[model samples]
Target chain A: MSRIVLEGISKIFGSKQVEGVELIRQGKRKAEIAAACGAVVGLCDISFDIVEGEILTLMGLSGSGKSTLLRCMNRLVEPSCGRIMVGDVDVTRLGRKDLLAFRQKTFGMVFQHFALLPNRTILSNVGFGLELKNVPAARWNEAAMQAIELVGLKGWEAKYPHELSGGMQQRAGLARALAADAEVLLMDEAFSALDPLIRRDMQSELRDLQQKLKKTIVFVSHDLDEAVALGGRIVLMKDGEVVQIGQPEEIVARPATEYVARFVEHIDRAAVMRAGQVADRSAPVLQPTLTVAEARIRIAGEGGDAWLVADDDRRFVGCLLAARLAAARPSETVASLLEASGEAVAAESRLDALLARVAAEGCVAVVDPDGRLIGGVGSRDVVRALAAHSAESQAGDHPETSILQQTAGAERWTGASRNFPSTRSATKASTGSPTMALG
Target chain B: MLTTALVAVPPWVFIGLAALATYRIGGRKIGLLTLFGLLFLWNLRLWQATVETLVLVSLSTITALVIGIPVGIWFALSRRAWRTFSPILDMMQTLPSFVYLIPALPFFGLGAVSACFATIVFSVPPVIRLTALGIRNVPTELVEASDAFGGSTTQKLFKVQLPLALPTIMAGVNQTMMLALSMVVIAAMIGAGGLGRAVWQSIQRLEAGAGFEAGIGIVILAVILDRSTQALAARARPHGAA
Candidate 1:
C-alpha cells in the first residue's frame, strides 16, 4: 500500500515590485512590481507513491531539488502548489498547530551535520525531539536512553557533542531520530559528512534498524552506490523531476532514461538480481520414472533435459540433473541430488544482497515473489548487466536495449542446448507456441 | 609624611593583595615578577601615592562592570534597544575623558567622587563593547541547535549563550580595568588624593626624587592590577577547567 503520496507539487519563489520612474516615463498612473525576483521552480510536477515499510531513496546532485523534495514531504519547506498526502491526512494544507502535531507524530529527520546541541549531553540531544512533543521528562529520558542504546552509544550518553567523535555525533543524531518513534524517517545526506568507514557502518546500522522497525524511510543521497545499497526502490531525480523509480535491479538492468542509466552503469548487477533469476526449475510432469541413469538418457533424447521429481499431485518435489545421473542409485530419489541452490530470487533486493547471494549460491536466479522463474543469471550476468548499463550510460542517450539484447544472446546456451532439436525449428515453433517457449 | 601615609597605604596595600592573588592564580614566576615590581616601587618611596590611586581605580572599575553588564545584556536581547543605544555607546566611547571633569566637577565636589565619575566615563566603554560583542559572536548554529532541542528563551540565554560569552566579557572587563587604572592618576588633578597629589606636590617643590618615587609607585600599581585582571580573565575561560 502507498503510505505517502505527492501530487503536482511545485515551488516558486519571488515577490512583486513596482518601478516608479519607468511608470512615469510610460505616462502610467502606477508602476507595479512584477513578481520579479524571477521565480525559482524548486520542484515541478513531482508525484510518486512510497509503499509502506519500503526505503524510497531520493537521489540527485545539489540544486537538483532532492533535498527540497524531501523537505516538502514534512512541510519543512512549503510547496507553492501541491498536495502531499501521508496516509489519510493532507500534510501540505496543515495549519501551524496541526502541522506541529503532524511533524511530532509523523516524521523524524536526520541531517548531514548531526545538529546535536553543544550544551546538552547525548541523552538530552536525542531526547530533544520527544521533548518538543511534550513527552514527560522521565518517559522521554527512558525512551531516549533506549534509542541511544539502539545506536550503540550506551556508555557515551553523558558526553557533550564536542567531546564525542564525528561518527559518534552522527550516531547521536540517529538516536535522536529513533527516539522520536515517528512513522516516517527523512534523511538528508545523513552520512555524507562522516568519514568513509563510519558512513558505511552507519548505513549498515540504518539497514538493520529499518528491518526491525519497518518504518517508511525517504533517504536523500548524491552517491548512487549508497542509493543502490539502501533503497528498496530508488527515485532517481534530475532538475527537479523524477527520472526513474524502481527496484535497484530494474534501475541497474533496465534503467528507464539516460540520466538513470548513467547512475546504474557503475552498479554491479549480479549483486542486485536475486537467486531466483538462475534457479533450476522442476519439470512440469511426474512419471513412474526409470532409474536416474535411464531417466537422464530418455529425457535427453526426448529434448526434456531437466527432470522434475514430484509427488502424485505434481507438486514440486525435487530436481534431477543430467550430469549427476551416473552417481545416482536406483533406490535414491532425485531429492538426494537436489543440492540446496542457495540463490536469492527476489528482484527487489539491493546490489549488496545480490552480490552476497551470488557469492553464496555461485549464481543466483531471478524470480518474482511467487517463486516463478523470471530469468537465469550468473557472474557473467552481473558483468553484462553492468556493461550494458554502462555502454548506454556512456552514450548518454536512451535506454541501452541493444547491448542487453546482445548479452542475452551470448548467454542463451547451456547444458540443455544439445537436447533441443534445431535453432531454426525452435524459432519457427516459438512464433506459433509462446507458452511452449516459456516452459 | 602623614599625608603620604593616608595616600600611600591604600594603593600599596591593594596592589600587594593583587600581587598575592596573581601569584596564587598564575604560579611562581608571575608571583615573583609581581613581587619585584612592587618592591621596586617601594624602594622609590612612591608606594604611598600609588596606594591612593589604586583605591580610585578599583572603585571605578567595579562600578563600570556593574553598570555595563546589565546594559550589555539588554543590548544583546533586544535588537531595538541595541539600535537605539548604539549611537549613545559610540558617543560615550569617543568623547574625550578630560571633558568629563568640566561637567562633572560642577555637579560633584572635587575629590574621589568626581574623579571616580571621570574614571567610570572613560573605562566603561570596553566592558560594554566587549560584552555585546561576546554575546553577538556566539555561533548561530548553536542557538538553532538549542531551539531545536526545545530550550526556552531563558534557558537558551542562561545555559548556552551566557556561559559561552563569559570569557569574552571577562576580556572586556580586564581591558576596562586597565583603562580605569590609567585614568585614576589623571583624575588626581581634581583634588583626588593619590600618587598624583604627591607628584603635584613634588613638582611644586621641585623635589625630583619625591616626584620620581610617586611616579614609580603609580607604575607598579598599574602593572600589578593589569596582570592580576588578565590572569583572572584567562582563568574564567572555558578551557581553564582543563
Candidate 2:
C-alpha cells in the first residue's frame, strides 16, 4: 500500500491564492498563472504515490518546488488545494492540533543545513522530539543511544553540534529522526553540505540504513548523481511539475521529455545499469541432454570454442569445450562432455564488474539466483554496448540521437574489447579462439 | 514585600551576599574588590547613604525586569505589536531624564518612593529594547526547525528562543541596572535620601570634600552592581560537557 499519496496538490504563494488556484484548474502553467494573477506557483497539480518502505527522490533545480512538495506532504507548507492521504487519514483535512500530533507521530525531517539546537548536546538534540512528547528521559535516552549507535556516533553524543563535523552533525540529525521512530522521513538535501568524499560515504550508508530500517523516505535533491547513488525511484521536476517518475534505468533509457534527457545525460550508467539490462537475452542455448555429435551438428554453423549447456528448465549445467566435445563419443551426452571453464555471473551484476571476467574469459554466462541461465555476455557484446554509448555521446551534435541512447560506456577498455567493433568479427573470433587454441 | 524585606536587611548583610554572588559568578578578583570598596564606604561613614542608594537601584532594576521582559517578548513575537510600540519606546528612552520626575513627583509626591518610581521609568527602555532585539534576532531557521518538529509556541519561547537569546537579554539587564545607579544622584533632587542627598547637600554648602566622598560612594555602588549583573549574565549560559 502507498504510505503517502499526493493528488492535485497545488500551492500558490501570494495574496491572490484564489485566482492562482483557479488558473491552475483552468490548466495554466506556472508562468501563465503568475502572469494572470500576481501569485507565484509553488506547486502545480502535483500527484504521486510514495510507496511504503521505499526511498523516492524529488529532484529539480532551485525553485522548481521540490522542497515545497516535500514540505506539503506533512503540511509544513500548506498546499492551496490537494488531497494528501497518509494511510486512511487525509492530512489536508486535519486541523492544526491534529496536524502537529500527526507530524510528530509520522514524519521526521532533516534539513540541508543541519537544524540542530545550538544550546543542546548531541544527545539532547537526538532526544528532542521525545522530550516534546513528554516521553520520560529513561526511555528516550535508551532509544536515542540505539539510534546514535546505528548512525555510528557512539562516544560523541555528549558533544554539542558545533563540536561535531558536518557529517557527524547530519548523522545526529538522522539519529534524531530515528529516535522518534517516525515511519516517514523527509530529508531535504541531507548531505549536500558535506564534502564530496563524505557525501558519497553518507549516501552509501543511508542506502544501507534504508535497507535495514525500511522507513518510507522522500529525499529532495538537485544532484542526479546523488539520486543515482540513492538507488530509488526518482521524481524529476521542472517548472513546479513532475517531468518524469521512474527508476534510474528507465529514465536513462527512455527520458519522457527533453528536460529529463538533459537531467540524466551525465549520469554514470555503469553504476546504475545491471547486467540483466545489457545482457543478450536472445542468444541460443544447448540442452545438457543433447549428445556431443548432435550438439556438433546442431551447432554446425554457430562455430565457437565453447557452448553453454543448460537443462530442459534452462538451469545452467556447465560450458562444453569444443575440443572435449570433438574428442567425445558420438553417443556421449553434452552434460558428460561439459567442462567448468567459464565464469558464471549473476544477472544483477553491473557491467563494470563484468569487464574483468569478460576480459579474462572470452564469454561469461549470465544466470539468475536459482542458477537458471538467462543469457551470455561475450567480449563482442561488451564492446558493442560500450561503442554504442561512445558513439551516441560523441554524436552529441544531435540531442535527439543522444536522448534515444542514454547508456554511458566504461572509461577503461582492454585488448579484448578493442577487437570487436562489429558483429562479423565477433562471430569470426568465437571460431578463431578455438583454432588458435588447437594450433 | 520582597523589595521591603530587601531594604530592611542590614547594609553589611546585603553587601556580604552581593560579594558572595559576584565571587561565585564573576570570579574572586571582582568579589574581593567589592568587599574592600563597601568596607571603604563604611569607613567614610557614607554607609547609610550607600544602603539607601542600594535599595533604590535594586528595587527599580527588579521592577524594570519584571515589567520590561514580558512586554519585550510580546513585541518580538508580534510584528504588529512591535511596530505599534517601537516609537513609544523610543520616546521613553530619549525624553529628558527630568521629564520622568515631572510625572513621578506629581503622582507620588517627592520621596524615596517617587525617586524609585522615576528610576524605573527612566531605566526600563534598555531592557525592553534589547530583550526584543535578542528574541527577534534569534535565527529564523532555528525557529522554523522548532515548528517543524512540533514545538508549541510556549515551548519554543522558553526552551529554544529564550535560552539562545539569554546572552543578549542579560546585556540588556546590565544596561538597565547601570542606568538605575546613575539615576540615584539625580533622583536626590526630588527629596530622596541616599548618597545623592549627601552629594546634593555638600554641593549646596560648597564642601567639595564631602561631595567627592559621596561621589566616590556612588562609584563603588555602581561597580558592585555592574560587575555582579554582568557576571550573572555570563553564568546564564548552560554548562555542557567540554
The candidate maximizing DockQ is 2
Docking level for model 1: incorrect
Q: DockQ each candidate and list the results.
A: 0.17, 0.41
User: Against the native chain B, what TM-score does each candidate's chain B reach?
Assistant: 0.86, 0.93
Tens digits of per-residue lDDT, candidate 1, B136-173, equal 87876455444434455666687667877887898888
Alpha-carbon deviation at B30 in model 2, angstroms: 2.0
- Winner by TM-score: 2
lDDT of 1 by residue, A59-157 (tens): 888977898898888776777665788999988777866777777787888888877766578998899878877789999999999999999999999
| A110-197: candidate 2 lDDT, tens digit per residue | 8888888888999998998777777899999999999999999999999899889999999999898888888899998898999999
Q: Residue A421 deviation, candidate 1, in Å? A: 39
Q: What is the lDDT of residue A179 in candidate 1?
A: 93
- How far off is residue A319 in model 1, in Å? 5.8
